[model samples]
Target chain A: MNTIRLAVDGVNKIYAGQATRVVAVEDASAAFAEGSVTAIMGPSGSGKTTLLSILGLILKPSNGRVTLMGRDVTDLDEARLPELRRQHIGFIFQSFNLFSALSALENVLVALQLKKVARPEAEAAARSALSRVGLEQRMRFYPRDLSGGEKQRVSIARALATNAPIILADEPTANLDSHTGLAIIDLLAELAREQGRTVVVVTHDTRMQEHVDHTLRMEDGRVYEN
Target chain B: MTYPVPMARRNLFHERVRLAITLVGIAFSVVLILVQMGVYLGMMNNTSSIIDHTEADLWVTARNNSNFDFSLPFPEHRENTAKGVEDVLWVKKFILVWSLMKLDGGGSENVEIVGFDPETGIGGPWEMVAGDPRDVKYPKGVIVDESSFAKLGVAKVGDDREIYGSRVRVVGICRGAKRITTAPILFTSYKTAQELNPWMAGKTVFLLVKTAPGADVAEVQQRLRAVMNLEDVYTQADFAWATKKYWTLSTGIGLGFGFTILMAIFVGAVIVSQTIYSATIEHLREFGTLKALGAENRTVYGIILQQALLSGLMGYAIGLAINLVISDLYRRTGQLVVQPWQLFAADLVVTLATCVAASLISVRRAMQVDPMEVFRA
Candidate 1:
């Protein structure tokens, strides 16, 4: 009976182009609960990433309401969305998206600093987050110098450093080896069960189902519970 | 946080070669602008050097006198007319003409002949390196600047040359007596000048007037104008500025130099814009990630603007350092290249402004990046 941390009610996303119209997500409805890991499994071009983008507040849905912690936020101003995302949502990208110029420690520090955390405290928090991801020894290594698994660990540390309530990961293990991918999935499950943070992952790998608490399937821009 | 990560600095420094090339481009533009502006100012200063260094309170010349180098002769009696004015302590006749000097080797070089009374030392050479200003009183004696030795084909004091086909001995050597036209300057007595150029006899080009102590120079100029109704009257400062204006505006030098400065700015702006834009394009995915991570537009703008400012500051520093070295070298070679503090300040402002303006293009591109792009594999 956990509270619904994030939910989208009949949300629709349409990308209108000069030559054609794309219904990226059509009448999508789903609820993600706190203290649980949910995986949205879908094929290519199935609008899973689009739905995740809407949930992360990175994209605006054309119609329908979005609820976060029981408050409807669908009609919020665009200007207010960034602050809201910064305060509540943490994003993990498929490519790890680490600033190549910064070291792993600095990558985590940037996330905390963006939330206006004090520098002294932000540094400690970044170090602690990196340690939590078991990357304490590789904190000073840049993205170009690290392996794929280490880069993904640094990305997870950056997301964890923000301490956001909801974590939205788009293909978090898409670029990692099978063993490393399972380890990352296990880490996300540990973050949900142990830390009580609602974690939603959009992935095409069926192997993630064994590690997640709930699973949903997406195809042709529609979502179905499994 | 008040101080975010040094992302801008790190980003610029990431590609060492590109950064070096960018800085070189910016520094080159800065140096070009500074040198051109310095040369223009130096030439303008030279145009008015004679009027600026003289001790005369007022200058009376023929009506509609264009500049110090070019003037019509008035009757020598105007000196007496100027002397009669109230508050006028004394007045001396000044002669200035252009003639060819017969070089000792074979060819002739253009020379500006300046004649003033040696007794009063009015309108005479102010900085004498060798011999004396009064030495010009000797018959056919002339004072030449050491800087003009190569052009005039004379080595030192006592060297002989011919002015207007008349033999003249260099009795003195002066320093820093340059003209805007780059012609060698020769100073002589009124008698010797008239002896060499018979056309200037009984006619003077200017009258240098000294006023009594504590007298209003402007009032004295007005009185002299009333007494010599047809001649132009100017205070020393006014005359200097008029000479500068005539050379700067009446001639096309100002327009040419202005065009050069503008072109330098244009080239600098383009270089800066391209560097920043390319850097932005290279890190487009990182910027998209920042946006997806909830960075505001202002933060992105701040980072890019910081990079531009850092580039500007470093480039300007290097350029100024090089300019100072070059200015010193030019000074040693007896070429005046004036770089005042005001010029440095203005150049810095222009550099920063160009850098900031250049960053707008990058900022616009960064703003258009969709945050969702980071999610695509």
Candidate 2:
């Protein structure tokens, strides 16, 4: 059996307002194994993104415990949580989220620099990461100069450059055409399987299930595995 | 890990038009504050230059003398009394009178008539740009400052001008004898000044006393005060301070300059804060992305602070370069000017502080950026 790189037990997330309380995730529990690709699939408002956010440590559960590499982080202080996130988690956003001011190589290098990698090594690592995504030729282009697939590839390179064991991608293919989206998913799955890192992708695209080791369907804030 | 410098430079330079406008605003504020301060300093220097440049160790004036502008005169015998004081190597009778000058053309100009004893040449124009100081001893002789040559309608030595209807020849021309009262000054012998202003015939407005080397100035002042019995005894520095204090605090010029300075500061802070705040808002999503990438609040603050300081530094350099040109223009106007290094250093600190203060609003907004927006968007 593969080692479980991350797990969340009985996690719940709710947004409280003066007049109402909205529950984003309810009793969502799942274990993502190392060296495998997992897809959390659900329709809109089904809490798939919320579960991904919680797993990425961007949002804290209203009630639950989170385990990362065998350590519980449910009670981690907010001040120290970012440091922990930088050291362990890498994220690929739906909008690509590349810094428009930076070139593709700098976008990746900035992420590595934030991860506390030295400049010289960060440059080498950024180049290698961009090459891994077949974007070496486009590494010097700004996000505005690049196409949709190129931008997505730059973000993937940014996430990969961090060398974190857990990569969380939210609706990674939502803005891409099917062919480009499939190509990205295939690259991600191969990188995860070959590099022994866990990749959890949140999506409603049923085609994503074909390339992942397992699919966990989310509905109304609840999770069920297939 | 530490891309604050590059990040700030890129962010500020991204929009060239906005960047130029922001820099211009900052530079204008700096220049306004600096020029206002320079003018005030120039005014102070003009007010005290007569005393500062003179070679007198002790000055004796009327007991309630407010300033050189409206000086009160005492009996000429006070000079003899001061001369008797121990350590008083020499004493010269000094006179000052405000009189109308009969210009060569139709109109008349206001003139400050300053008279010093020709024997000692004390309290006389020190910077002789042309001609000899001794020539003022000639009949109805006078010396005009080079800076006031154009205003006095005289070109060179041997040029003639009339003061209080007396045709006085400009025996010499000197520089840096600046006027604070907006009137050009004409230097003459005590006898000629006394003859011109009959009211000053038997009186002297001031006694310029020189002390021997190693003589205690305070002791000489004490002895002169006791000997004269009715005049105020002042060291050179005390009289200069008194003159400066009267012009700066007694008059409203200081308040006017001070108010303008505060306004400049307000305008600068507003412009800088608005520019930086607007830029931050424009890049709100970028900062959100940084937070999502696990950057701490301190990191965001660092970035904003770096941006502000960068603008301040560049703006300050540009402002100073412009000030150099402005100072030259001011110098041509014949105003007393001094820009010590300390002023530049202090202004630099103030400029940086202004920029830092202006960045607080932006930094607060930047720190509150929600990393979740990167995903939600």
Residue pairs clashing in model 2 are A113-B1
* Residue B114 shift from truth in candidate 2, angstroms: 1.4
Report the C-alpha lDDT of model 2 over B1-377, residue by residue, as the tens digit: 33422778877887677778778877888888788888888888888887887789888899989677678988998777777778899888889888888877778888888898777677788888887777889998988877665766656788777767778888888877777777888788899889888888799999899998999999888888887778898999999998988998898988998898888778878888999999999888778877778888787788789889999998899989998888888877765557778888988888889999999999988877775777875
Residue B161 miss distance in model 1 (angstroms): 3.0
Best by TM-score: 1
User: Measured with DockQ on alpha carbons, how good is candidate 1?
Assistant: 0.75
Which residue ranges in model 1 land beyond 4 Å of their true spot?
B1-3, B86-89, B211-214
- Provide i-RMS per model in Å: 1.2, 2.0
What docking class should model 1 receive? Answer: medium
lDDT tens readout by residue for model 1, B1-377: 22468899989988887778778878888898899999999998899888888889888889999689998898998787788899999888899988889887889999889998999778889999899889999889999977687797655787888877788998999877899888999899988887888989899999998999999988998888888998999998888889888998999998999999999889989999999999998888888888777888898899999999999999999988888888788778777898788998999999999999999999999989877779877
Best by lDDT: 1
